[model samples]
Target: MSYGWLDDDTTISTDLKTTKETPFYEPIVNNFETGGYNPSVSYHYNPDVTQYHYGVRHPMKPFRLMLTDHLVIAYKLYEQMDIYKPRRATKEELLEFHSDDYVKFLETVTPENATKLAQTLKKFNIGDDCPVFDGMYDYCQIYAGASLDASRKLISGMSDIAINWSGGLHHAKKHEPSGFCYVNDIVLSILDLLRVHPRVLYIDIDLHHGDGVQEAFYLTDRVMTVSFHKYNGEFFPGTGNHDETGLSKGKHFTLNVPLQDGIDDESYTRLFKSIMEPVIANFKPTAIVQQCGADSLGCDRLGCFNLNIKAHGECVKFIKSFGIPMLVVGGGGYTPRNVSRLWCYETGIMTNMKLNHKLPDELPFRNFFQPDYSLHPNLGDRLDNKNTKKYLENLKNQLLENLRYMKGAPSVAMQEIPPDLQNLTTDEEQAIIDKLNSESSYDEYLENERYWINEKDQARKHELVE
Candidate 1:
């Protein structure tokens, strides 16, 4: 293999002697454990993600996810969690939020025809930003499936914390794709959560705004959207202003923490906690979906924030502390290496494993680190902190003041312990159901046979009656 710039970054260890392969990670207590004190976690991953690539120098890399998984394996984080392959999201599931025409276009678009269908490309904004590549639809479905799987885990009480690092495509709208995000997986996951959770809170810490998700549930009181992003001039998809609260019934349900460049650990953490504490207390969300986009880190090529790995991770640590069923995902991380590191570290955090800071000797991306070999890289204060303390404090106050519209927790009708499926015992209800079922039999074959046969087909019935 050619030693590229990535190889040059690694500081060769003179001492070939190896440290312990496994870090100080605490393995989860499984059913076979001594006391059977198992932690609830369901991890969704698909290796198929790495095979696809967004064009050259597109800033969004699919291999980052594979590298993140490699680090997670090197750190033995999988041992502490239940790992499962994400089932592919069906077309019906994709139709949950996407329009029929939009889905049709994505389902059929290809790199070959991307230029031929110029109107369709313009219609969905699928040029350079959201390009048509090999396995584009399958890639979206894989990540979306992973996210939906995580959501199902939360909804069924199967997991307290679910991780789908392939997800967090936050910029795709119901009908349009934008910002390197072709499908809004976050919205699909939240839609699933709303079926079980009365109130779901979405927290996005990506560098750019989560405009797609925000607008998806903008008018619903059942889900509250909170996004912290760099809302300065010339930013892409710029819509997450502080005053863009929810409309009508969802008034004050949307919260946007718009910050300037160079937001560090201290200021960001302080601001995050200050806003999140009140949100949790008042909103009382039964579940949460947090997009941990690592592009906000200081060393990221596309982001302006001065946040380091630990600082970016503190947001996940804080969100996980609430102990609510959370669907954690990745979004908008340009620096693929740092993104991998950030996500691997956060996965360790979610598994409740106090891992050693030492990088494993057999790390797949060992050569990716720069002169410094430690997991904690020195990415300190590359830019000035434009988010002043006073301004941030005022923003917090504005949020608190605006929240007065919501007196208490959001509401949804409680589901019965065992839903009254037979409540329609009345003759009219039975007649309607029976009539519908009988009428539907014309479209469907009705019989307790090995395979279905058309009951309405007289010729087929005569042929079948041997």
Candidate 2:
């Protein structure tokens, strides 16, 4: 179902009506100049046209105000980084991962078709989970293009790190749509990288498993898929069992760490450091893709975890610590306001920008919810819990065990198998051929891959002079 938070017309005006008497409406925008703002400081809030009468019925609306407020805070911080720029993704780039047919379908979907498509929601998997709104395709393309832009920036070497807070719709598949995702931008971006790099590492931190991406590359060793998410049982779209490793040459390439709910920052960090860090280091990938889904946060509507904002920030920090080219994307976050702020704060940290403490005075729908510093407050005040510490220690032990196992593990190099001379069955022979083909393509693939490497060189040159 389309969460009501996605409504475009719900603006700061709604928020003001609900919490006008509270201290939350204190204006904090007097100190900053609108002229210094980054054009990329996009605000998704739009005022509702219908005037509200006294005692008029309204849906649960405070969450949207929270998102807009957080975004205003984030945008103020983003200004310090000077990294907001829009870039387009080329057709060849999009086709790298997506089917030509699907790409064409996305381009052709119109408002009329959207209505008909909505009627047959099951056919397209576009009802409540992923509603076919008026501009759904356009929104998908914007995120898809933004992801492509981030990938291009990395490939070009313009910046070692980049983030598209709007991207990370990871549930979309090659031929079908699932969840709220219409396009698997992460997969497409990875496909774009395969053209330039021999090995790419993908990490998904969304509370839900990155099943769509895992399915796409289940048989390829060139891409290492690592996902850490909640897996209690049949939680949204299922899949992502630990045993669901890659097939053939890709068998051990996929790693699924199913975490329990209520995992706090310390435990989450320990899991990353102990398990993901070493695995990535050993793999020695040229690039990394991270989906920093905000749903993992404590107060998310759909999430069961208890992680605060600092915990989310730590995930970004940990990934960026690798010093490899990294692209950060946004994923699930039902508590739009909180998650947006979380991401905004993350972007600031990643870009080496100073974090701003203030928010806009008058926000769209500012009155919708009373801002009790206790209920939906800032992360600066929350303290780490004891459970977080214990979880970390447990994760450390797991990592130690894994490292010991790896010490006695076989070499990563593939063993050459001679062609079968005996008349083996065609199907059996084809399987072997497929494995060899995937392995052999790695070398020649990287050589001819044309990425935005030159553009990155130019951007870096420009940054140096500036």
Candidate 3:
């Protein structure tokens, strides 16, 4: 049951050789003083994630985040950016998206007592893709917390770009887990953004459909969910259909461009710009959440898309160009080595610097991207490019036709559901506040994080800022 070779330190580095031996690992401090400016970017990463295992040689390696984090550091990305090791998310915060019963099950169920609650496990699909391993709850909480923190930062106007390699668990449903996701961190993050921004756009570039996020807001126009994914019905989770637009008040608010397998970069970028240009112009969202899942790349173990690292990062650049406050998070990248490379490259994209790809041998996990010892190695069109220009064109044509239905924004009033409700994910503190206030005070009782209306993370920025 142990898969130490995949995650253990001994297997990864036998000689305990330090990065000091390698020239690339030597950090080059980039001073904005030279250029008179550095873009405001914040990154949330937790190294403790690598300790939890899914009990087999699985694709969802938590250590992938660690590799990406270190790769960013090796390239000295941390110096240009504001980075923080975030705190684990709270049960109450998680309740924003997950059901109370599901939250309770996750908090109380242990590997020892997991079999005792077989019904719960079965209901949530908490085996195989998502397993009931030791510290599974903590694993979910820690990563989910980082994403929530990032969203808060964006909402506070503190960071123009916030990155969380620990997040974008976009497939988990409200009542149960699905796909490899247990907690739908993207959903939770989007829900938090909904509090401040009148309209929020959720975009998933993962190979798989962003089912959980789409489902969570399928009935509301407040959030417009757009996903570009390989949507074969038989594929995992299998739900992002083109016609599965939002319902009732949320009609035309959802867009799914289902591409075929082996879609190359040129085809992808064209479709991305074509679809996204209109969606952004029409929906006019005030804020955005992007799921940058590296699994969409060509050489991925499970994915069939032919996007290169630069192609994957280009989507981020395009979104950033809109000048909207954005939260960028990682999702399904099965091939861990490629995941590291893709994310590291994207980190540079966020900081607006093209990093040196001629990686020295001293980099940790350098062997993963072998043969040509380069950061941006040409993975090339390894998949047969099953998608032709016509197929991609047809897909684009269909999406354009669909967007024709999305003219006027939804006019549904924001539901005034109490923060604490029956059979709901209720905030306990909110209940106490409701009880403490008198009728007059209750009439003027302001909800949401009022104290943080003008607050920000005390950013420990560069000496130049001093």
TM-scores of all candidate predictions against the true structure = 0.83, 0.65, 0.81
Top-scoring candidate (TM-score): 1
- Extract clashing residue pairs from model 1: none
Q: What CA RMSD would candidate 2 show?
A: 15.6
Q: Local error of candidate 1 at 329, Å?
A: 0.7
lDDT measured at residue 275 in model 2 versus the true structure, 0 to 100: 75
User: Which window of ten consecutive residues has the lowest lDDT sum in model 3?
Assistant: 3-12
Ranking by lDDT: 1, 3, 2
Q: Please report, in order, the local distance difference test score of every candidate based on alpha carbons.
A: 0.83, 0.62, 0.81
lDDT of 1 by residue, 1-466 (tens): 3422213245654333333432445543334433343348888999998899988868888999988998889878887789999788878889989999999998999988777898878888877788789889999889999999888877777898999999999999999899999889999988877766788999999999999999999998999999999886568787888899999888889998889988888999888988898889999999999999888898798889999888888888877777778899999898877888889888877876655555666787688865665566766599999888899989999988887778888668967452222234568687998999898886555343423333334445346542
Candidate 2 residue lDDT tens string, 58-104: 22122333453355452454343334445445455566676787667
C-alpha lDDT of residue 95 in model 1: 96
Question: Stretches of candidate 2 above 4 Å error?
Answer: 1-75, 79-93, 109-111, 114-123, 354-466
